[model samples]
Target: MSDAREPVTGIEVPINLKYEFTAGAALARFLSSIREGRIVGQRCPGCSSVYVPPRGSCSRCGIATEEEVEVSDRGVIESFTIVHIPLPGNPVKPPFIAANILLDGTDMACLHLVSEVPTERVVVGMRVQAVWKPREEWGYTFENIAWFKPVEGA
Candidate 1:
């Protein structure tokens, strides 16, 4: 005997709460740098680990990071995945690549979208660089750098 499946349905719930999020000291500076088409990382004097998107303190040594270090825009893709699923409010369309990149001179990796290359061509160790939006479009946010793309001649 064969079994039949039942149809499932649910009501659409919409959330409309108004709220504001403030990025504290370290993060605020990091975002500001991004807006200016530059990337800055904070160095942990104790352990010397550099964090992109600058955390106020070091995760390993538990000491506050104070030195602002400029990091290279180009980096190697440590890991990545080609996404095929679609979701509401996704910044990019489906079938895009999301990557974890280790910016040059930094100790940690930052997650961001990778584009300008076919999904099949993306791989771990692929060199990529930030593709920033027009200067007028920048703000104190991650949106400043539109996305990352493969570095030419690399």
Candidate 2:
């Protein structure tokens, strides 16, 4: 018998190959804060460390966390980077920004977007604030807050 193979079908599709955890009541409640237009962080009473994602425990303190703190939009840049590539499903363009935003009132750093300023001007210690989108576009992700911009008149 001959060993000829059959021809493959037509379309080559593009798909996002990554996924996330869809469980946990604590995580669900944390995500809901975005839709409510608020930045929620949980602090570890044992170590007094804060987490922006508001996890159920604190690694540094080795204890559970439940104190939910409403964080401010204003923060100083602890660290930052200029991304030359795009993440799958990323709404912004390449060579934009990806920064570790340390919220003003907490000892935590969360990754976030930086906008309204050229990449060349972003300094390590510059102050910035959340530039939120319209209420209609709020969601359960970081995109809920549009981006961080340089503090006005600074």
Candidate 3:
């Protein structure tokens, strides 16, 4: 046997996943509102807490959320992170800000990308507004809002 060992080589196996998602009634309403450039949430009758991208029920009170509430597109950043690592299939490059935004009138924060401002400038309580894609490209998806950005004069 030779003292030298053979070098190991590896091959990349690409995997693709495709599936159809059936949205419940509450989620369907949320998605539909998103397509129309409106952000809607469901209010829990018990606690009156509003949930964006409403999950059909209130986590706190354990009751169905049926009242649709329109929330402001502008919000405050509750927390955020500056991403430096690349994520596969993500079109946005590194050095992006991912933030949990507390939209006006909503009790829960939603995660979204913050752009059009310096990463270092992003901070908790920073005011931001949705930067929506053109109306022509509207679809039944959250992608309708391309990203959020710091609101001027806010």
Candidate 4:
């Protein structure tokens, strides 16, 4: 018997998914602050750890975080990786710096793009600051900040 392969036809199904969830009380406040060009964190009364993008609850002590604290836009890059390949839906273009930054006076780090500096020059502990988009573009999202750039004299 001769081995013959059958061609398989692929069917593409388009699915449109739409759903929304309330960010809850804590996160809603955090998002609203972002829309207003402010960075806020909640401090845990138990451990005194501040969380950017506040969760309203402390993972360490299992207690609710109540005190809202404004953090600096400038932060130190805790780690980073340069993307060399293009991927769909990537906000920043290829060959961009994606860094985990620990904001000043906060204990947690967040992931964001780093621009205005050479990728090769990106280093851990390097100070960076948010490069916000036009004020008109600020909405109920973090996209208001276009990307982060290294701070001068930092």
Candidate 5:
């Protein structure tokens, strides 16, 4: 009997996934607020922590966050990195700054793009503000704010 056999090789399987995502009440409210050029978050009654893009409950206290807090587009960079590699579907070019921004009046930091300044100059605690797209381009998504930039003299 022949003992030799063909070597096993991997097969490429293309996946096509389609589904509907219903952003529940908490997120729906957040989306609506952003659509109107406002940033709103829910305050946790238990721990008094505010969550932007508000999760329905508080991670620390495990309680419902009901109080809506309006936060400024301005924030401080808690941390950041200068991305030098390009992503497959990301529109933003490489060599850009991506940051974890602690928006004013919120306890948690949100991820966002930083621009309009030299990458070498971006630092922790640097104040930045949202640079929104034209009003006509506003939508129910965070993309409405094109990116964040350093706030002069801040």
Candidate 6:
């Protein structure tokens, strides 16, 4: 006896709600950090780069970041680009400012929202600080801090 096979045909399927890796240590740290009103990052002693939201290991050095670096609220704006398109899931008012900030004391730069100042006022060397949101609305997301604001001095 032999078996027959079906001819080649392309069919599209949709993905519905499904279960997944819900929570773990990383998530717990996120919750804890928000409640304490601080931005924390993990660092790899090998490469000397700190990561936001903390990571178990370093991507470049291939080692664990056992040290937790308390990043300064202020950082220098390394680079940025103006965004003219508005897409779904973006809560910011259109024509907002987004940039890569080389945070103080860390060798890495992270992308985040820039605000509290006009878009035209922003520059590459601009110094900005982390502006935290109210304690009540501190969720598990990075939005705990509303945006980066221009620092008063240094």
CA lDDT of every candidate? 0.90, 0.84, 0.93, 0.89, 0.93, 0.78
**Which pairs of residues have clashing backbones in candidate 6?**
none
* Candidate 2 Cα outliers beyond 4 Å, as residue runs: 1-20
Per-candidate TM vs. native? 0.88, 0.82, 0.90, 0.86, 0.89, 0.77
Find the 10 residues in a row with the least total lDDT in model 6.
22-31
Model 5, span 1-154: residue lDDT tens? 7668786687788777899999988999999999999999999998888899898999999888878999999999999999999987799998999999999999999999999999889999999999999999999999999999999887
Candidate 5, position 105, lDDT: 95
- Report the lDDT tens digits of candidate 4 across residue range 1-75: 865877667878877788988897778888999999998789999999999889899999999998999999889
Tens-place lDDT digits, model 2, residues 1-154: 8768887778779875677768455566677987898878888889888788777888887788888888898898889989898777777788988899898888878888898999999999999999988999888877888889999997
Candidate 6 residue-wise lDDT, 17-65, digit = tens? 7677564565467557756777677788887888766656778999877
Candidate 3 segments exceeding 4 Å error:
1-18
Model 5 residue 136 CA deviation (Å) reads 0.3
Candidate 1 per-residue C-alpha lDDT over 116-137 given as tens digits, one digit per residue, 9 for 90 to 100: 9988889899999999899999
Q: Which one wins by TM-score: 3 or 4? A: 3
Alpha-carbon shift of residue 22 in model 2 (angstroms): 1.9
TM accuracy, model 4: 0.86
**Candidate 2 vs. true structure, TM-score:** 0.82
What are the per-model numbers of colliding residue pairs? 0, 0, 0, 0, 0, 0
Task: Name every residue pair that clashes in candidate 2.
Answer: none
What lDDT score goes with residue 123 in model 6?
95
Off by over 4 Å in 1: 1-19
Write down the RMSD of candidate 3 (Cα, Å).
2.5
* Model 4: CA > 4 A from native: 1-18
Ranking by TM-score: 3, 5, 1, 4, 2, 6
The CA lDDT at 148 in model 4 is 94
lDDT of 3 by residue, 1-154 (tens): 6658667688789998898989999999999999999999999999999999899999999888899999999999999999999999899999998999999999999999999998878889999999999999999998899999999998
Best-performing candidate as measured by TM-score: 3
- Record all residue pairs in model 3 with backbone atoms less than 3 Å apart, i.e. clashing: none
Error of 2 at 2 (Å): 17
User: TM-score: which is higher, 5 or 6?
Assistant: 5
How well does candidate 4 match the true structure, expressed as C-alpha RMSD?
3.4
